[model samples]
Target: MSTLTPGEQAVMSRFDLGWPESDIAADLSISFARTRAIISTFDSNPAHDRHREAQIRRGSQRLLARLRKAGGHR
Candidate 1:
């Protein structure tokens, strides 16, 4: 799988947290158009669809990894 940029990762993080597109844009300091484009690109990517299905079965391990990276305890 291709690596996501930090901005893309931030967008996905907020999206998974149930934040709206506008809110994500505002919170991340990204333009709404760019945020929407990232979301649209992710939605259209077949790999992301497969990843989502896998995550649904396995739970959100990736979020845990992010937390760990940010110094959260395991």
Candidate 2:
């Protein structure tokens, strides 16, 4: 895959790190509405949607790893 932009990387990283959308928006200095709009645009395109799904899957894996490391759950 192509390298993501810094902003996209930040968004992906925040999501991968288990930050909520509101928190991500706050950290990125963006409004929640803008965040929602971005997500909507990502979802609306088939290719982008697939890419986002992969990102989410990767994020979920990272979250699971953190949980395991913390002995939180299975």
Candidate 3:
């Protein structure tokens, strides 16, 4: 919870992107059971919520930047 391991970050990113757990496992080269366990742990963490919120904020900022660049907004 203090810091996310690289695998955890990958799992979380794939999860957020709505990838199937099976695919996440295969892509991460982990067993499906272990993949589910890792994702479950990620889902249970408060840090996971924080991570999602941070990602949403970053996405919004990116959208605003694009809008400004296109003169869609001032």
Off by over 4 Å in 1: 44-74
Clashing pairs in 1: none
In model 3, which regions exceed 4 Å deviation? 44-74
Q: For each predicted model, how many residue pairs clash, with residues at least 3 apart or on different chains?
A: 0, 0, 0
lDDT of 2 by residue, 1-74 (tens): 56667876777677666688899899999888876655545333688788778999999999999999999975
Q: Tell me the whole-model lDDT of each prediction, alpha carbons only.
A: 0.83, 0.76, 0.87
Top TM-score hit = 1
TM-score of each: 0.56, 0.45, 0.55
RMSD of each: 13.4, 13.1, 11.0
Could you give candidate 1's per-residue lDDT for residues 1-74 as a string of tens digits?
68899989999888878899999999989899999879866755788778768866566677777788899855
Clashing pairs in 3: none
Query: For model 3, what is the error of residue 3's alpha carbon versus the real structure, in angstroms, after optimal superposition?
Result: 1.4
Model 2 segments beyond 4 Å from truth? 37-74
Query: Candidate 3: lDDT of 1?
Result: 50
